[model samples]
Target: MALPVAMLGPTVAQAQGWPTAANPDEVFLYPEESEDPVLLYPDDNSSSAPSSTPPLPNSPNIQPTSVRSLQLIGGEVLTEAIAQAFYRTQLGRPADPARLERIAFAIDQWYLDNGYSLSQVSGWMIDAEGVLTVEVVEPEVNQITIRYIDNEGRALDDEGNPIEGRTRERFLRRELQLQSGAVFNQNDVIQDIQSLMALEIFENATVAVDVDEESRETPVVDVVYNLQERLSRSFQASGGVSTELGLFAGVTYRDGNFNGRGESLRFGTQVGSRGLVFSTEFTSPYRDSRPERLGYTIRAFRRTGRSVTFSDEVRLANGDDARERHFGGGGSVMRPIGDWDAELGLNYSRVSIRDDSGDLAPTDELGNDLTLDDSGIDDLLTLEFAVTQDQRVNPSNPNDGSVLTLSTEQSIPVGNGNIVMNRLRADYAEYVPVNLFNTGRRQNPEVVAFNVQAGTVLGDLPPYEAFDLGGGNSVRGYGRGDVGSGRRFFLATAEYRFPVTGPLGAVLFTDFASDLGSGSEVPGDPAGVRDKPGTGLGYGAGLRIGSPLGLIRADFGVNDQGDNQFFFGFGQRF
Candidate 1:
C-alpha cells in the first residue's frame, strides 16, 4: 500500500490573479490547482477534505454550519493573541468550508512573516465535543551555512583563496543572526542579510531558504548565506588643506575583518604645515555578548600656531608664538538600553605647551604674570560618560530621523596643583524629508537638517581643550578656529539638501555661534572667565557629490567678520 502525501500549494484563486477579496485564495491554500476551486475554512461545523480516506470510524461527525466553539492542536508556536484574532474573525459567522482554509492561510502567513518558512497548516478535523482541531507542522532550522561566491560563480574569497568554503563558514558563523535549531523567522533572515551587507568586508550578501522533504511529516530547513566578499584590507593615501591646520597629507591602513572576526582596526598618520598627528583605533561590535561594544583609540599630536588672547579686546599679545603637544589613549565600553546607549571611558594624557616668542610672559595659577621659565607640563587622568540616542534612518546621510548625544568628561591632575577641569557637552540633529516637485518618487527627496551643539568647562583647562568653533565642520562662514577658543560656546546650524541628478546634489546652510568666556584665561584663576562673548554668523551654499569613497562636500561661505572662505571635505557635516 502507498502512503498518503498531501501538500498545501498555491491556491487556484490566486493563480487566476484575482484580488484578495474576489479570489478568496488570498487567505487560503489548496492541495491542487483548478480552474474553479471551492473555498475552505477550518471550523467546528465544516467538513474539510482529508489528505487520505483513512478509516474515521471513531471520529465524530459535525455539521457544515456555524461553529459555536473552536480549538487548536499542534499550535505551540501560536500565541493567545493570534488565537483570539482568528477566533473573532470566525465566531457567530456562518461556517463555510472556505472559511476554514482562509484561517489556515492566515496562520501560514503569520508563520512565514515570523521566519517559520517550513511550517504549514496541513488539515483539520472536528472532535466529539464539537471543537475544531487544526493540524499544523512547524519545522525548525537544522543548520545555518555560509558560502562565498564570486562573479564567475566560483567559490572563492576576495584574495582568490579556494578554501573560502571553510574560511567563509568560520568568518560568518559568529555574525549569523540566527543559530541552528532555532525556529525559523523571516525577520531574522532579512536582518542577517542586512548585517552582512553593512559590513565593509562584503560587497553583497544573499540568503536562500532550503527545505528537506524526505520527512514529509516533519520537515527541517537549512538557511544558506552567499556573500561576495570585498577586500579585507586596504591602504589609502589622501591630502587635504584646512584653514587651521594648513595643507596636510596622510596614509591610512584598514582591516575590516581582523582575526577572522567582525572586528576592525585602523592606523593612520598625517603631516601638515602646522601639525603632525598619528593615531590607531580598534573596535569590536560585541564583547563576549550581544548589545555590548568595545573600542580603543590612541593618538599623539603636535601643532604650532599663533593664538589670539582676549581681555577687553582680542589681540596677539606677548608670548603669542605657541606650540602644543599631546599624547593620549583611551578605551570605551558601551551597552544598549532601549533606543539609547550608555558608555564609560577612561584616558591618560600628557600635554606640553611652549611660547617661542620672548615678549609673551606666562601666567601663574593666581592669574599673576610669571617669567617665561615658569612654564610647566600638565599630566591628566580623565574619566568620561555619555548617553546617546540615534534613530536616524541613515548614519551617513539621514533623510528622516533624530539623534541626541550628551557627554561629560572630568580631567583630574596626575600631580598636585596641575590643571583639572570638568567639561559637559550636548549635540542634537534632526532630519526632515520634503518633496519639492512631488514627482511621486520618495527616494532621494529633499531634506532639511538642523543641528545644535554646546559645550562648557568648569575649573581650569588648557586653551587647546577650550571650545573652538568655526570652519567646515563648525560655523562655515568663518576661517577654522577664528570664531573663539573660549571656556564655553554654543553653535547652531541649518542645512537644506535638494537633489540635482543621479548622485549630485546642492545644499544651502547657515550657522551661528557665540563664546561666553575670554580665550586667554589660565587655570585656577581667581578672576574667573568673562561672560557674554561676541557672536559669529555664517551662511553659504555648497555642492554635494556622492562617490564610492563617500560624499564629497564643497562650500563657499561668508562670515559676519567680512571673511569669505571656500571649504572642501568628505561626509555630512554632522
Candidate 2:
C-alpha cells in the first residue's frame, strides 16, 4: 500500500475534454472486410483477412429481348383446383361427364320441339388441362307432318271412304289443341289429350312419334293419331243451398246429339222453405251457336210464410193465422245485345189468400167486420224484361269480380179494373279488398257488399190488394207480416267474411229495413196502414265449413229488441 504513486496509476484510458460521438460506419464494420489481425480468415495471405471473392456489384443483368421464355407455370396448376372447387360448391357434388351429357340432350330436345329440328351441342377438351368449352348450334326447320286415323284403321273423309285431303296434314296440325313452333312439354301433350277426350267425341285417343335415324342432321318426325266416335246421351244430378232457401237438390238429363241434330231439353225442381219450384226448358242448338241463343222455360211455383199484424200497439194476434199461395207460368226469349244480355217474357199468375179467425171478431175502420166463407183469388198478367252481365266466377262462391243485374216487372189488368202494379228491382254486389295486416292463414277478407231491394203497389186497393215483406228470407230483422203498405219499402244488408282455419270461414252480417205508407193521417185500415213507422236493425254471424255436401253453414243473429234467432243453411247469403 505504500508503493510509489507513478507506478500505481490507472491502466484504463480516461475521458478527455469535449468527449465526441461514435462514428456509426466504424462501429458496424464488416468482419470479412476488416484489416485487423483478429478478424482474419484462414485462406487470407495477409495477417488481416480479406473476403475470398470480391462482392458482386448490386446491378441487374441485362439480356437481349428475344432470349427469355415467357412461360406460365402456377396458373395452370391452380386453374384445375379452381374448376373442381366450382363443381363441388355450385353443383353440390362432383360433376359427371354422363350427367352433363344428359343435360345437353334435354336442352337439345327442347330446341327441336320449338321448330328447331337441327339442334346440337358440341364439347371440346382444351389441351387436357381439365378445361371444357361448349358450343350450341341451331338449324332451321323444314316442315311438320301430322297423320290422322280412325278407330277401325281407316283414313276416311266426309264420305266414309279411304281418302286424304290435299292439305290434310296442314289442316290437322292447325286444328291441334297444342300449337306447333311452341316448346314441347310432355305434360302439355297429356293435357291436350285429356281435353280432346273431354269433348265427348272421342272414346280412344293415341299419339305416336317416329324419327329418321339415317339423316341425323335433318331430323324428321312422324305423328299419328287414332280416335273413336262417341255416344250421345248423358244425365247429371247437382244440389246445394242458399241463405234464402235451406237445402235443395235438382236432376238434369241432356241428349247431346238429339236426333243427330243437336237439341236439348231440361226439367228441374227445387223444394225448400221457398216452396216448390218446377221448371221445364228446351233449346235448339242450331239456332245461332255463337252469340245469339233462343230458349224457352216454363216455370211454376208456390210459396208460403207466416203473417204478422201491425197495430197502434205491438201485439201478437191469437187464433187462426193467414196464408197465401201463388201459381205462375212464363216463357222467355233471350238474345245477346252488345256487352249485355236482354230477355223478354210474358208471365201469368194467380194468387189466393185465406184468413181463419177462430173466436176473434174481424174488425174494420168503421167497427164493421165481415166473415168470409171462402178465400179470395186475384189473377194478374205481367210483362217482364231484364238485362244483365254477370262476370262472377261461380254464383255460389264469388271470388274474382262483381255482378250487376237490372230487372223491371209491370203488371196490368185486362179485366174491368183500373188497377196497376209496378215493381223495379236492382241488385249490385261488389268485392273490395281489405287492407288487413297479419291476416294469418287467410289471404284476404272483409268483403264490403250490400243488397238493395224495393217493392211498391201503384193503384187503388180493391179490398184484396196486398204488399207484404218479412219472414226468414225477406227481412231477417222483422217478423213476417210486420211490414205491409200501399206505398214503398226497402231492405238493405251488408256482410263481411273472416277466415278461421283451413276451409272454414266466418261471416258477420247486418240488415236494415223500413216500411212507408201513402196517407199522412193514420188510416184505420187493418191490412193497409200502420199507426207507427216500421223500422228494424239486426246483426248476426255465421260459420262456413267445407264438407262433402259443399259448404255447411250455421248462423245466429239478434234483432234490436234482443230477439235471438239462428239460421242453419249452406252456400252464400246473396
Candidate 3:
C-alpha cells in the first residue's frame, strides 16, 4: 500500500488501485512490494536458500551396514578418539565402498556442524583394504568485496566513475555479514539475505561466492550481494467512505527509499462530509545495517469537521452541524521488542470546539463550550506509549492468527491548555479458520473472528475530546455517542466470514458495547439531553470486496432501537 494518509486510500467502489487508509494520528504500514505491485501486501516470511553448500549425496547401503576399517587422512584436529567417537557403529562390522563414502561424508558433515563451514572433504573416499581416506580443506577469507549492477545493469569497479545502484555501497558493505581474514561461514550468507530483504528496498537479494585458486595455501573466498531493486517512489489516489467521516476522496504520495538511504517520506489529504483532513510523515531507521533496527517518525496534520457527539451519517434536518477543528505535529520513536513493536510519542495540538449554543454550553463549563466561536483554543500536549503484536497470516486480510495492541496517553495542561486527562485503550482481534462450506467458494477458508476493545479516561476531559462509541465503527444500530461518549467504554464483536466468490466475502456479525454506566464529564447534562443509553447492542451483515486499493465493505445493521441503516467503510472494523 502506498498510502501515507489515513482514511484516504482506495475503496471498493474506486478500486482502480490504491493503498489502505490509516488514522491520521496513527503510524500506518506503508507496504513496499517486491514481487507484486498490486493484489499483494508483503510476504513477511518469504524464504531464501538456507546455505551456500549444495546438498551432499545420500549415503548408499554398504553390505555390513558399518565400516570395519576406516582410514582418516590430513586433518589438523582429527584424533583416534575423535574417529572412534563418530564411527563407533561402523568399527564393529565389515565395510564396503558405500560404507567408505558414508564415512567420508560423515566426517565432512562433522566439521561443518562444528562451525568449520569452509572445511571440505574430497569425494575420493574408498581406498585399498576397505579403508576410508578423507582430506579436509579449511579455507580462510582473504578479502571481502561487493559486486553490484548500476541502474543500467552495468557492473562497476569499486572506484569506477559511474557507480552501481542508487543505494550507497557503504550501506551494503555495512550489511554484509562476511569479514576478511576470517573463516568463511556459509550460514552468514543466509543471514545476509534476510538482512537485505528486511530493508524493503530490494525485489530480491542473493549471495555468490568465488574461491581464489591462487591463494591455495589457505584459499580465500570473495563474496558478492546481487540485489534487484523495487520501485522506490509511488503516487496514489482514491475515494472511499470512512464510516466515521462518510464519503470522501483523497490522494497520497510516498518515497520508500529516499536519498538512497532507507528513509521514507509521505503526504496525503482527503475531503469528506466530516471535513478536510491531511497528514505528512517522515521516518528513518536508526541504523539500516544492524539486525536490531530502531526507528523514528515525525508527523503533522490538520483536521476539521469531526464530531464527538451523535452526528448521524445523514445531514441534520436543522441545517446545523457542529464539528471540531484541530492541527498538530508529533513524533514517535519505535523499537521492536521481540515479537512486539513499541512506540513512544509526544504531540502538541490546538483544538477549537465551537457550538453556536454558546449560552447553552460554555468552554471549560461543558468541556469549554468547544471553542466554537474560536474564543479559546484547547491546548493539548500529549505523551503516548503503545505496543502491538501482530501474528496474522496476512495482515491485510487474515484467514487465521491474532493481533493485540495496548496504549496509554497522558495529556498535560500546558500553555493555557487547562484540560488534563489520562487515557488508556486496548484492542485485540483473533481469526480462526473453519471451512464450513462443502462447496460454493464459501470454503475459501471461512473464518470466525472475535474482537474486543476497551478504553478509559481519567481527569477532566474537554467536551470536544470524547471517546464516543456506537456508529458504523462500533455498535451498529446506534449513532455516534448514542451509547454515551464517556470516561470508560468496552466493546466486543463476533463474526463469521465466508468467501462468496473471487475477491468477495460475506460476514454476519454482532456487536455489544457499554459506557460502564459513566457518561462524558461535561459540565452540562448533554448525556441526559441526548438520551444516552450507557449501553448498546447491534446485529448486522456485511459484504467485503478485496482490491488492490484495499478491502471495501457495505453493511446493513439494526441498533437496539430497531433503527436500520446501511453503512459503507474501508478496511475491517477491527
Candidate 4:
C-alpha cells in the first residue's frame, strides 16, 4: 500500500520525489531529472484549444503567475547593496562592497597566518531576485611557520638566543607592543611595529602578510627583525636649593650590566646646609629571576639645627649652636608578598649631639655664663620591618591617589645601659582633588596643606628625649627647639603654592601644633610635672626662582609672638 500525498510531503520534499514503500523500479536511491514540464493549478476555468494544441502544463502560452525565474551562478554575488546593508547595522553607515571584501580578505589572511589553513566563506542565494547570505567557516589550525632572523642572522639556540622563540603570530597577537583585539586595524599593527622598533632592541623589524588566492585559506606572514645590543650605563645629576636646606646636589650612576649578568649598581650624594650627606646603594634584581631584589645602603651626614621644642617659654640661655653628626648603614631584602611589598633590614646608627649646656638647672641657677660640653654619642642598632602599599596614578606626577607606609623599629644598645627604644611610626600622604574654588592656583599663594604625623617613643628616657613638635617644619609659628618632651604631637598646616611665571613660584604656609609632654623630668628635676603646653600659629610667604642649580628660595615668616625671621634655601618646602 502507498502512503497518501499529505503523509509523504516531508520525505518527498527532501528526496524530490522518492517513495517510502515502493516497488523495485520505484525504490531508486537517487532520482533522475524529469523531462516533463511543471504543472500548476489555475484559479479560474479556461477553454481548451483545438486538437493540435498542447496540454495546459506544456503550453507556452499558459504562463504561471506564481512561478518566478531563478538563476544559479557559479560564484557568490556579494553586491555593494548587500554589503552596505549588512555593515550599516553595526557601523551606522553604508559600506562599499569593494572595501568590505578587502576587509574580509584581510581577516581571512589573519586567520590563516595563525594556522587556520582551511578557513573559507560560503554564500547562498536567499531570494531568486535579490537577497544573498554569506557564512564564514573557520577550520582548526594545522600548522604555523615563522621566518625570522636574529641579531647576527645566525641560527639561535633555545637557551642562548633572545629571539629563539619569537614567531610572527606571537608578535602579531601576543608580543606586539600595542593593545590587542582591535578588530584587524591595520594602523594598530603599524603602530605596534613602530613601538617595537622604538624599544631599540631591534635594528629593524618589518612585518607583512600574504594569502593564497586560490584557496583563500592558508596565509604566510613574513617577519624580519635585526637586533642590536644597547649600551648598559647611564648617569644623572640634579641640584636644587631651599631656605631650610641650602645648595642640595644629587648625582646618580648606574651600571645596567654588571658582570654581564644584568645587575644594577647606584650611588648618589646630596649636600646642603641642613646636611652634607652621601649615600651608596647596590641592587641585584634577578637574584632568582622572579624580580626579587637585594640591596644595601650606607649614608653619612652632618646637619646643624637646634632641637625641636614645644615649650611656650623661650629660655634665654638655650644653646643656639647645636648640630648633629649621623652615620648609618643598612641592608635590606625586598620581595613581593601578595599585593603588598615587604622589606626587612638591619641598621646601625651613631647620633652625636653637640650642645653647650650640659643639663637643665633651676630657675634661680640659670646663668648666661654657663656653657657645658654636653656632646655625647648614642649608638643604636635597629631591626626594622616595613610594609608599603602603593597605588598611585602617574607616580612621576603623583597628583592623585594615596600611599601608606607602616614601619616598626627596635633600638638595642650594645655598650651602654640595657635600654631599648621601641618605636612605631606610620605615615600616610593622600592627594585629594580640591574643588575648583579651593585650588591653590586660583587663590593666594599663601595657603598650605594640612599634614598629620604621629609617633611614639616607648622606652625610658628624660622628658627631653621624647618627641617635640615646635619648629619650622613642625609648628611654623613657634621657634626652633622650643617645644619639648612629649610622646605625641598633632599638627595641621595649610599651604598655598602659585607660579609667578618663568620658573618663579611662591608659597604661603601656616601651621598649628600642640604638645603632650611626658610630665617627667630629668635626674635633676624630680617634680615629674608636665611642662606648660603652648599653641602656635604662623604664616609666611616665600619666593622661588628656578635656575640651573635648582630652585633658590627666600622666605620671611612671622609667628604669633611678632617674631619675624628670614630663611634662605632651595627647593619646595614639602
Give each model's whole-structure lDDT: 0.62, 0.45, 0.64, 0.43
Model 1, 1-574: lDDT tens digits are 1111111122311332312232332234322332212234344344443222111245454466556676665565775555556655555555545555555655665555455545666666565444666666666778776777774556765687862621345556666667777765666776676566545466556766666758655767677677766555779898998543568998989876777665777888888785667777787653323434454434333333443222222222342433444567778776766667778888876555444432333452234432212454556778999989977754556778899999999986665236578999999999988887553122234888999998888986665566766778888877666676667778999998888777788889999987755455533221233322246899989988866455788999999877889999976787
Top candidate on lDDT is 3
Q: What's the distance in Å from true for residue 468, model 3?
A: 1.1
TM-score of every model? 0.69, 0.47, 0.60, 0.46
* Model 1 TM-score on a 0 to 1 scale: 0.69
For residues 1-574, what per-residue lDDT tens digits would candidate 3 score against the true structure?
A: 1211111112210332211221233222211212111111133122321121222244333344334465555455455566555555455466534333334444554555554554555434433354544455556656565555543455555576543566877877787776776666666666677677667676446555666757466566666567766566778898988643568999989887888776888899998786678989999865535647668999999876546562433212233445566789999988877788789999998776433221222233323254323455677889999999977754546678899999999997776557678889999999998857843242234888999999988886765566677888888777766777776789999988888888788889998998787674543434544678878899989999865345688888898888877888866776
Q: What is the C-alpha RMSD of each candidate to the true structure, in Å?
A: 8.6, 28.8, 15.2, 20.1
The runs of at least 3 residues in candidate 2 whose Cα sits more than 4 Å from the true structure, single-residue gaps closed, are 1-289, 302-319, 355-375, 415-419, 435-446, 460-468, 471-474, 481-486, 516-533
Point out where model 4 deviates above 4 Å. 1-290, 294-296, 300-323, 335-339, 355-375, 392-397, 435-449, 462-465, 519-534, 543-556, 567-571
- Cα lDDT of model 2 by residue, 1-574, tens digit: 1111121111100111111211222231121333321211233233322111111243223222121111112122123343233223214233333333333333333333333333334331212223333334332222334444554556686697753322224323433544444322234344455544433334445655343434665343333455543344566676787332456676656554344433445566666554455555554421222343464445555543323433333222432343444466777777766676677788876654433321222333344221121224556678888887766533445544677778877777753332366666666677544545334232224455566766555543433333445544445545554544334567777777666776787778887666665322112344434443356677888887755344567777677777766677756666
Give the C-alpha miss distance for residue 385 in model 4, angstroms: 2.4
Worst 10 residues of 2 by lDDT: 10-19
Error of 3 at 211 (Å): 19
> What is the descending TM-score order?
1, 3, 2, 4
